[model samples]
Target: MSKIYVLDTNVLLQDPHSIFSFEENEVVIPAVVLEEVDSKKRYMDEIGRNARHVSRLIDSFRGNGKLHERIPLENGGSLRIELNHRSFQQLQDIFIEKTNDNRILAVAKNLSLEEETKEDGKTVILVSKDALVRVKADAIGLLSEDYLSDRVIENDHVYTGFLEVYTAKETIDRYYEKGEIQASEIVTFPLFPNQFLVMKDALGSSASAIGIVDKSRKKLKKLIFDYDHIWGIKPRNVQQTAAFELLLRKDLPLVTLTGKAGTGKTLLALASGLLQTEDHGAYKKLLVARPIVPVGKDIGFLPGEKEEKLRPWMQPIYDNLEYLFNVKKPGELDAILAGMGSIEVEALTYIRGRSIPDQYIIIDEAQNLTKHEVKTILTRVGEGSKIVLMGDPEQIDHPYLDAYNNGLTYVVERFKDQMIAGHVKLIKGERSGLAQLAADLL
Candidate 1:
């Protein structure tokens, strides 16, 4: 049975060409959706860029046939604007104001009624990115679904790089005595190379050590813990330990980490970069940059050079640095940042057209990056360079990106099976007690 998929404005804003995703079925764009798109088309940021893209997409279809009328799509679906479904009479009876949500719901309800009246009884489903819209659709007895057009990973089983194996302590002891052990010998569980193993005695004993081995049974050396324990930045669980393994892997040219805020994604990356660059001399320099996607609140523009303009967005990166370096005075960290031009901090805009070699590149807030933008950044890696992408998918500020299709998640999903690339999803909160609580509650 051909189903009618009603698209919300968010789906269009997220991906301008989203209408083409549904094949061999009817795609209905509620009239209110256009109004919402029009309202967002005048800005100069990502949202406005997407709105204009949506406008251009809708305009392009007019050349094929009249979009306001039922037109056949190339993929065997019919595209049409819902003209007869703009019934505000039912909504105005309940609320005096004509809210956008109610208008959208009214359009969906009218479409559902029209489908029910048809003899074939085809289904009408409302597609939206809003949770409340789905609830409202359910209230009106309409089939509703989240616009999961870009989800990469299935469910929430994100990449956690730690594997726990329960074996005889003698098995681990024999491996240490022999200087190596075959991965197949650990029969209790499967293992991924470069993955840290937390071996516990199957006999209910408490023996565990973090170690990494390769397919050739060669063990990589571990870094020494020489600093004060990061109290608010402890790994909450094994997932974070797995995240640390990826963060510390110098052989992996590309690394991606995703999780919620206060999950220690940024802190762990910064800590590992510092250890590898300053202490271990693994990489020549540490180059950290984040896409300057403004949060819900903007602090206005700064008047000065590029560094001054970047201060606001780069402050979080600096905060992690200041804490890691234990700078007591105000200008102490700045002096250090100035002295070691080894640490290059710049905006993503300036990183284009420059090849970075023999350095550790960390791009924070990568979830806000576009697919094209991410490709541009990744291609700039020179020989002996490692790039790490980290961000929170749930807190995206870019209008055209989503949890599934955002550049960060896109890179992680596309390169997951590759040996030189690794990904870790940090699930624990280690920023602070209140921040963790807010992260969990909010």
Candidate 2:
């Protein structure tokens, strides 16, 4: 039996193309969902952009039939902006308010009852990205689920960008002696390009070697910048060494670093960017940007221009910079940043419609970005530009994003096999003992 999938406003705002995700099944967008989406068509953020995109898409679909009627999608399914079944009579006892969420519940609840009387056994399920909406659906006896089409990797199988393989003592010795070895001779499982491998002795000895797979995936070569200190910062572990290799390399323009907080994802990227820009003169400037997704209550409107307004959002970047420069006095970091005209700290919102060239770009808090938002940023990279995207995928602040589907995790998986990309997952937290314990236990 075919199912009827009702979409929430957040589902469409998360992925505008989600209307065609259901295969050969009816997709319903409650009328209240449109109202919610319409209310967000301005303000110029990612959500507003997605709202406008969804509006254009539904308008394009109107060529076939009216929105209230069944509009045939190209994927052999149908879309209908449900105008009926919005009666709050059934929900009056349970829900006190007539909010948009309640109205969506009303539609889904009524659809289930209407479908139950049919001989076709059509099941009704409300597809929402909001947990509370799904909970309300269940409280009112409705089957609901999260939109899963954007999940690139499962939760347990999150990509760590590296693997451990135990090999014979001779193999490890030969690799160290020769500086390279054929990957097929050692790794029995599938491997991707630029994937770091830690070769340990199968005899349970203390001997171990680390190397990254070559672009051809046929050979594993030794790391180039493993032990070197860049910008007075040394790698505390093997994962950080691998990240430095990717960061300093001019060939691989795209690098991704993922781990819990205090793994030094932002610090390492900044150090490498500074090394290449200030010492090596590899790029013209160092550009750092991050999405302004807050963790808790926002500070509300600030009274200043763009740079002053962005100071709060960019404070973490400044903190890393101050630590790197060993600034002791108040506002000393600001003076240092002003002296070095090559360093630019910016918010990701202004990055649109820009073509950045000959710069070392770092996007921190990348876990808050959507797939489309990441694509927009990546496409801005011009010739001689290298971009590093670093974030803790497990610590996302965006309401519509999770670890598996955020932009950082998406890029890590999609570019794992690509030649221009390299990724590392920093497991150890180097910030402090308490920080590492909080990261692991709490």
Which candidate number would show the highest TM-score if scored against the true structure? 2
Which residue pairs collide in model 1, if any?
none
lDDT of 2 by residue, 1-442 (tens): 7789999999999899999999999999998899899999995888998999999999998889898999988999999999889999999999999999999999999989988897876899999999999999999999999999988876668677788899998999999999999998788777888889999999999989998899888899998875457778899998998889999999999999999999999999999999999988999999999998888998798888999999999999999999899999998988888988999999998999999999999999999999989999999999999999999888988988998888988899899879999888999999999999999998
Task: Looking at model 1, report the run of 10 residues with the lowest lDDT sum.
Answer: 220-229
lDDT of 1 by residue, 296-325 (tens): 887787899877888888999999889888
* Per-model TM values vs. the true structure: 0.82, 0.97
The residue pairs that clash in candidate 2, if any, are: none
For model 1, the stretches where C-alpha displacement exceeds 4 angstroms are: 39-44, 187-193, 213-245, 258-264, 275-284, 294-296, 352-354, 368-373, 393-407, 425-442
Sliding window of 10 residues with minimal summed lDDT for model 2: 223-232
Best by lDDT: 2
RMSD to truth, every model: 4.1, 1.4
Per-model lDDT: 0.78, 0.92
